[model samples]
Structure formats: C-alpha cells, structure tokens
Target: MKKYVQEATDINVWTSLKEDTFDRGKDIREFIEGLELIEGNAFISLDAKWGDGKTFFVRQIEETLKYFRAKQMETEEKLLKDLESYEYLKESVAVKETTVEHIYLPVYYNAWMYDDHNDPLMSLLLVMTKQCGGAYNTKINTKSLGERLLAVASSLPISIKKINPATIIKDLQEGKMDILSAVKTEEDIKECVRDVFNDIIVEEAEKLVVFIDELDRCKPSFAIEMLERIKHYFDDERIIFVVSLNKEQLIHTISNYYGSEFDATRYLNRFFDVSINLPEISWYQKQKVQCTNSERFWITLIADELSDYYGFSLRDKLIYKSSIESLPRDVGDAFSQDKMYLNIFEVIIVLLDMVDAKEKKAFLEGKSNILIDLMPRIEIYKKYILRSFGIDIRDDCEEKLTEKYKLVQEVYEYVFGRDTEEYFKEADISRNLKEICIKACNGLKS
Candidate 1:
C-alpha cells in the first residue's frame, strides 16, 4: 500500500501550503511573523500529538519566512533561477506577496536524526553552519567555535569519546588540541558560542529563526540534553528557536529520564518562553467542497467521518485513503448499486482493521452489535448510507430522525447479522455481501 510521505523541500512545502488544504496556514504564518516583535532570544514550542502534521506546519512557516527573506534581498531573478525546477512558484510568488517588514533567517533541524551524536550542541552548530553556508553562499569559519566546543565537551559530565570529531571539526580532524586550556570556564565557552551565532547572523540575516523538530522522538537523555543545551549555550538576542514536538511525548521522555514521580510538565515549562498547540482539524471549518463524482472525494469523506470518531491523525487519514485505493477497481465502482454499500463497507473495514482489530474480528465472527456500536453518528455519513436505501432525510424533525436512525441500524443488522439473513431476504439484501466483506477484511489482515 502507498504510504504518506512528506518531502522536506521548499518547493513541495510551497505547493502543499499554496493549496492551503487545512485553511489555517495563512493565519499561522501571520502568527509566526509576529514573533519578530519579541525582543531578545525567544524559545517557542509548537505542540501537537504525534502524526498530526506538526512538521508540515512548521515547514510551511519556514518556507513563508524564506520567501519573504528572499523578497527583502530584492533578488527576484536569482530566486526564480533557484526555483527553476518548480515552475509553479513562478506565478505563485506574484500572487502571494506579503508586506511584512521583519523577516528572520530560518533554519530547520531534525533533532531526532542527530540525537545519536555525542553532543546536541555540536549537532546544532553543524546544522546552523551548513544551512547558513547554503543560504549566504559563503563558508563560515568554525575553527574557534570547534575548539571551544571540544573544550565544552571535555568539561561536560558526559563521555568525551562520544563526540564525533570528523563531523564537528572537519578542519581540525588531523590537528591536536589540549581540550583543558582551549576555554577557561563555562562562561567563556558560552561567550564563544554566542560570538559564533552573532557572526552567523551578521554574515547571513539580521535575525535567526531556528526550527528544531522531532525532539520528542529522540532518546530520553538526548531529548533532555538538547533542551538543556539550547537553554545554556545558544542564548542570543538575535536568535529565536521554534521547537516542534508532541509535548505529551516529550514529557514522558523527561519523566523516563528523571523519575516517574518527577513533574515533567513543570520541568519542561522552564525550557519554552511560549507554547502553542497545533490546531486540530475541525469538521465545521469551511473546506473546499470536492466534486461528487470524484473517488478521492468519497474516500476522504469516509475516512474523515471515521477519523472524527476514531481520533485518526493526519497520517492515519492518509493511510486510510491509501488502503481504500488499493482495492480492486471493480470493487471501487461508485455508480454500481451492487458495489455502493460494498465500497462503504470496504472503507469501514480497512479503518476498523487498522485501529481496532479485535473489535473487527468480533464483528466478522457473527457479532453484529460490534459493528453497530462502532458506527459513526455523523449526519452526512448517515444521510449518504440512507440515500442508498431510497431514504432521503429532508427535515431535522426529531421523530423522523429517530426513525431514520432505526432504519440505518436495521440495514446494518440485515447486512452483518447471521440470524437476520432469512428475515431481510425480502428486502433484497445481497446474499454474498457479508461473505465478500468478511473475505476482504481477512485478506487485508493477512
């Protein structure tokens, strides 16, 4: 089955946000831009549950800042040349112009990817240097910074052998250094690190916005150490750190590192200056209506309804859509009456198998109430299913709605209940419908 993959590239991020699928991108971008008003070093946290698209949201903000930064440079020709591979941005840049005055240099670092390194500080510095090099087209001098890092690493309570010399100090790989005398004290090392950051800001952009993502996915020690490193070493007036993570998971990681009785939430609060929860997807929010004939439209609708009931993440919704797409084309025919309920069942079965296989197994094993209990109470899904049975719910009258729901329940019983086979035979319930659904569900599980 096709999996959901988010490409970490500027053009892909632009394309995804240009469509503004969630409709909250513009507002969130404006909020991020407002961070420029905050003086001194600011630490902001973008909190979301795992797989809820925190990474995508932050990347969208990153791209927006980069676009405006490019605009500030007045190098439209060079920008266009850089984006030559993505022709969509040629017109996009013109249409989506912002009047924001303050734009900071943005750097995205995936903390989980580099957590295996000896020091979070070293990993962070390397990323900042590399990204700055690409943005400014000039190599940054990290010799002094590298020596000081070695001194700091040596002084740190952690093992010095864990430090990867090749990655951090490429120029000093063959050179020898007395780590003891490189820096006098902790204050001296902090000052040197601050100077390095200042040099980067001076050479590249006036201000820096560093986005640290996936910290929660890192090891407990690594995650805690990263936060501590950021709080101590990278403090600067021209720098703003935006860290994206599932705060709950990070709290658990903290509790794991400390004791289970430790107050992880209170401890985590010390690291962030400001925290914002990533917006949850709301069904009531006005979304662009899809064409009724579109297969994707139906699949998305079904998955969305299930998501509301099951708390499926953005990733879960994508996976559910993919599972539905993997079925036989004949089984997916929307226009065929014989396949209408089958298509809906296929969508439901795929999701049920994903989230609650035990419940699905019980339903397949002659327990009709298992499926009935799991059915979503949303009006749109109910209306669509009822429409198949030639029942149109035109009014919101309580008695009529109740009667309609009972009809839906009876339809479920007729399709899934083994005992109702003889009773619903006159209603033209397909004899092979249950058998086909069971076979499909088993095939998916296997």
Candidate 2:
C-alpha cells in the first residue's frame, strides 16, 4: 500500500491523512520576532500556495491578543497600552503614544468587495471606529458640528431629554449650550481619528495587533488607493496589518483591474515588514504511540502525504487502488493505459504546456477549464523530456529530473535510445537549475 501514484489515479486532494495546519514552527517565530522590532511601515512577502495554512497563523495572532487580555473584549484595561489587543478613539493618541498606540487604526478588510478601493481610507475610518467599539452615528453625518455634539449630549441623561424640546430650542437661540463643542461633520469625524490611539495607551492595557487579512484581495484599481490610504493617513507601527495573500492571486487581480498601471510588487513593497512562507512539510506525528499497528499506519500515512504533494489525488492513490477488480496495469505510470483511461489530468497538463499558446488557447476553449489549464503544464514536462534528455514519448520527463529513480529500462530506451550520452547534456545542467528541475520532476512523479 506504500507507493507513489500519478494524478490520473487520484482525486479529492483534501482527504490525505497528512494534516495541514499552523503549528508555530521556526519560520513563524523568526518572522514575528523580526516584525516586533520595526519602527516604520515595511513590506514582507510570504510565499505559499493555497491550503498551506496561512490563515491558521493569523489566528495565532488573535489568540495571543486573547491571552494578553484574559479574554475580556471590553475591559477598561482593554484599551490600555500594554495589552495585547485593544480599541480606542482618535482623540487619545498623545496620551497613549508613549506605550502601545493605535494612531489611525486601519479599517481594511474588504469581505470580497475588492472594488471598494476608491475611498479605502474613508472606508478604513468607518471600520476603525467600529473596531474600537464605536458605533456609526447615522444622524451625526447629516448634522452641523454643534448639532452633532448636541446629539452626543442628548444621548446622555433622561433629564436632558425632559428639558430639550422647546427650552433646548430656545437655548440654541441664546447660544447657551454649545452642543457643537464635542464633534462635527465628516471632516471632524476624521479629525477624531487620532484619539483612538491615546485612549488605548491611557487605559494601560495590552496593545491590539489588528491584522487586516488581505488588502490585496481587493481589486487592483483599489489596490493603489488602498495602499495610499495605509501609507499616508493611517500610519502606525504598533497596529500590525497581517495580510493573507497568495502572490499569483494578488498579481492577477492587480493586472486584471488596474491595466498594469503599477507594478504590484513595487507598490506592495511599501507595506509588509516581515513575512514567512509556510511550507508543506512532512506531516508525521512525532509523539510515539505504542500501538501495535502504529508503524504500519505511520508508513502508509507518510506515503499518502508524499503522493498527495506530488499531485496524486486521495481517491486515485487509495480508493481506486484498493478497488477496481482488475488492477490498473502499470498503475502510476505517467503514460500507462489504465491511468490514461481512468483520469485525464495527466495527459492534459502535458499537452497544454507544450502546445503553441494559440493552439492551447483554442484547445482550452473547447475543453474543460481544469484540463485546459493542466494540459500546458503536462506538455512543458513532456517537451522538456524530449528536448533535454531526449526522453520523449513513453519516456517520462520527471524521471530525468530525479536522482536515482526506479523505472522500467524500457523507459530509457524509449527516451534516449540505447545511447543515453548523445542527448544527456552534463554541461547543460547548472546546479541551480538541476535542483529546481529535480524538485519539479519529483513533484510530478510522486
């Protein structure tokens, strides 16, 4: 049961016994330690494919804040400087900036509304107020500076309500109650933005490390706008903006929406201070279980992870292997008959990658998008085998990339003929490129 399998035999990638979750490894520790030291805005990039547990790490931040505050969401100390997490008003910075601060707290989660970038700072201001436990006062938006303050005053005591209707109106004529003293128009609301930081510090509690998951998730048109907002108005080092981004997704979103007006990396280069890539490492449980079957189970599990990471689906590697009365002849071969009939992905990835772009595009239009996208990759692989090692056709491309690979001798015959030396270019393989190709080959193989 312990063996490598091709993608053709597999499906449903999630069922692998190998777990994918954040476990606070060395990479995470290093990144956080580095992040804690920075004084100004910075940029960091964590390279990871989807499902590699980026979100899990962000949750760790939230957990740290919870521990610092003893799980109290709104303790008076919740707004304090030393606390791990906090909330506050714009008017309180000077008092709080000495310790933990929330200068112009970022309000940057788009909830999939990536197009909402035009007024990101304004949108951010709205969200920041909410984050600090402040409610949106709808009526205040329409009122004059004095009237807005009157509204805040009106919310205070029932006594004010009792005296208000006619007398309060009369007092307004006399200019007795300066209701406008506290707050005012939209501009003034923004003016109150800095107070949130001061409030958090004076509270003498933990600092709130707020992570805005993915500003990059927003559309490119809004990306620069959003970036500018973060750069210019709402600047603070203590309030960390932890982002969860897949680089390619960020790039595609940017190019599609922004017409390549700005380089995504160059633009993003300004924000992230520290980043750590979460790798898909071996998923073996280190704790020794004395169960009799533990060794067997562990062996099978490790094989499963290796297979999955190499592009085999759980269904193909496990379920189909055990089922299907007639065993798949040459089950995991990149070009085996049973595999070709059972799953189409293996063929598709190769065809798409090797074919002319226009041809690939036309084929993609006529075929399933999944297969279309997969085909090109497969073709690049097949062509590489043909061109590099002269191992075309039945001779798999990946085998040439591996160290001491196991394969039928016929594979070599089909690829480089009897004389492997005529095409195997020793000088052509640079160490750097060799390792990369080797890993890529291994990824495709097992």
Candidate 3:
C-alpha cells in the first residue's frame, strides 16, 4: 500500500551561490562582473517569466557579492583560509580587488512586499535609512545624508499617514522637522531633495547597487511610482539599479498607469539601460532537435504509452529506457523511424508526479496494459499524441482515422504481441476506451 503525504520530502534549498546545481549562477556572476567595469549610473533588467527561478538566481548573485565584500574586510591569513574552502572564489579577480571604486553597497528590496506604501519615497527612505550604520566600512556620512533625505521625503507632495511633521520627527527621532517647513512651492522641495541626493552621492565611498525585485507583481501605481522615483531622485552616476520583472507584465503595469491606448513598451524603455532574458530551462522548453538513432524515438514512444497505465513516473522513465534498449533489434528498428511528441527525460519526470511506488512498479514490470486505464482519459494526451504522428484531429477522414489506428495497433503488438487485443478487452477497458475515442471523433464532427 502507498500513502499520499502533504509535506515536502525532498528539496535542495540554496542559501548561497555555491549550491547552484542548475548552472544559473555563472551567467549572473558574469553580468555582475560586466557591471563592475562601468563607472556611471546605469540600469539592468533581469527578465524572465514568473516561477522560472529568477528570485533564486538573483539571490545567488547577491550572496556571491556579499561574500566577496566580506572577504575584502578579512585579514590576509583568514582570506587565504576562506579561499581554500570556497573554490569558486579562487579564480576570480573581482573578489581580490581592494579598490573602493570597485566596491558597492548592495541593497535588495522586494517591491511587491512593500506595495502598501502610499508614497514610494517613504518606502525607499525606510530602506536607505536602515543601512546608515556603514556596514561597508566606508567614510560616507550616511547618517547625515539619510536625515537630509528624510527631511526632503517628509515634505514631498505625496500623502503620508502622519500629518504633523513635528510629531513625525519626535516619533522617528531621525532628524529635525524644520528643514522645509517654511517652503511653499514644489520647486523648493525638489531642489532641497536634489541637493541632498548630490551630497550623498559625493559622500559615498563606493557606488550604491539597488536591486528592486518583483516590481511587476506590485500594484500598477506602486510599480510606476517606484520607477519614477528612482529615475528622478536617484539620478547620480554612483547609483546602479538592477531590477527584475517580466517585461510583458511590466508593460501591462505601465498600461494600467497610462491608458491602454498608450505605447507602454516605448515608455518603459526609458527606465533600463540594458535588458537580458534568462536562458530557458530544458524542462520548461523543448529540446533542440537533432539527428539521433531511432532507438531514442522508440524509447519516448514507450514512455508515452506507459503514461496511459502508470500516469507518470520518474522511476519508470529509466526502467522503460532500459527495457526498450533490451528489446530485439527488429522491435527497436520499428520505432527508430517513428516520431514521438514528448521528450523522454521530461515525459518520465512528469509521470513521476502522477504515480505511487507500488503502482509504478507493477506497470513497469509489464503486469498490465496501461493504455486501457489511460484510454478513457485520452483527451489529456490526445493533442501531443496526435502531433507525434503528424495528425490534426480536426481533419479526421475515414482513411486517416484507419491509418492512425493501424499505427497504434502496430506499436501495441510490438509491446504485447498477439495478446494486444485481448489485453484491451479485459476489465471493460476496451468498451471504456472505445467510448472515449467515439466521443473524441464526434467532437471532430461537431
């Protein structure tokens, strides 16, 4: 007997850059290295679809940068010991550079988590103020710069929850409240903020690297506000922003900010200097087509057929591959030229999610015709299966339908021999599978 459990059994959670088994960390490191060569304010967009591991990729890069910075602060003996333990650092010149110009104060902020902010400046101020303790050992007067920025942030035209600036000052105790109390015009506030920003940039020992993530998931207003604030307020050459978001979704977010009639793509282009798409993961995308032995195609075909009985199994993929290879040359030759819709590796992985241990073992061992179980649910695999044979279900003719069945039967016989028909007939499998096929054919008629 097998039981379904809700808790996670296996997961390799990566806390640092070295644990990257997916080969994603190297590309990100190259990007960071490229960014280090430039000396001006710039922007980069790490573009990828949601759930494609963008967060993990960026976290790895962040950890790598922090590790390098921490190493620079270590004694020579300690640094050598650390290098011996972490092999990836041994070949890198970026980790060895001791110049203040190459160092950065990296700050990561998740925009989606702080979208409740009525004013984007307040959220940014909170992030900047928290780092005023000079963690990077820079000579920058971060405390004074933060206070000046806060005073400017408090007087902005944007609405905040607190009304009394004096009360805000008393409660926060960050700075005096009288920096802009006498100012009447918007220009004065902007000028005050701009001056403080310039001073902060000059005062900093190293450049500021702000990584804004999940911007597309934030409210349209909040997303747009964050972009506008960074552009107008943080325009110094010493600041760099590496933002992550889906380009399409961010354009849609921009559409919500402006009307749908606007050219959102052209408008959003002003924010980023360079945009790079993450390389596609093999499991999520189709593999590149290549010439290979027909045995490979037959192997995938067996896996697909097995899917009908076993649902799916990671284990069966390996077993099926071995089983198919062990078949006589003539049987393997029959499938060599045959086409298959699913990738053998991916198909097996998908099946693993759909079956249990006992069920998978029985089916893989050839105790049953799995097709009968899967026949009634053929619609699930119908699209891909039909595609495998260069079939379009919408164009079903009598000759075409017969040809399709002939091919299916040939593959069926190769697996189960003369008992193929008898295997389907058992346990009402033939009747049920037929009914589903009839319904599918009728769908073509309608």
How many residue pairs clash (N, CA or C atoms closer than 3 angstroms) in each of the candidate models, in the order given?
0, 42, 7
Q: Model 1 Cα displacement at 373 (Å)?
A: 1.3
* Candidate 1 structure quality by residue, lDDT tens digits, 39-89: 888899999998777887788777767766766775778777764333443
Residue 127 displacement in candidate 2 (angstroms): 3.9
Per-candidate Cα lDDT values, in order, are 0.67, 0.38, 0.53
Instruction: Choose the strongest candidate by lDDT.
Output: 1
Clashing pairs in 3: 294-336, 309-370, 312-351, 312-352, 313-351, 313-352, 314-352
- Candidate 1, after superposition: displacement of residue 287 in Å? 4.5
Best by TM-score: 1
Better of 2 and 3 by TM-score: 3
Candidate 1: stretches off by over 4 Å: 1-5, 82-97, 139-185, 280-304, 331-341, 361-368, 375-446
Superposition-based RMSD of candidate 3 using all C-alpha atoms, in angstroms = 12.7
Of candidate 3, the 10-residue stretch with the lowest lDDT total is 1-10
Stretches off by above 4 angstroms in model 2 are: 1-22, 25-28, 39-47, 71-118, 126-190, 199-202, 255-262, 273-446
For residues 327-413, write the lDDT of model 3, one tens digit per residue: 223222222222231132223323443555564444333343444445335443454456555666677544664555455544443
RMSD of each: 5.8, 15.7, 12.7
lDDT per residue as tens, model 2, 1-446:
23322221112111110122223433444454555565554544555555444544454433333332332434565446544223322122211222222222222343244344235554454344444443211222212322333444533444543453445434443445433233345444334444444443324332334555555556665665665556554454445555567777777676666567757665465565566565544434211111112333322333333334344322233332232111222233233322322223222223334334564444334333433233234433234324434455565545463421222122222222233334433222222322222223224322
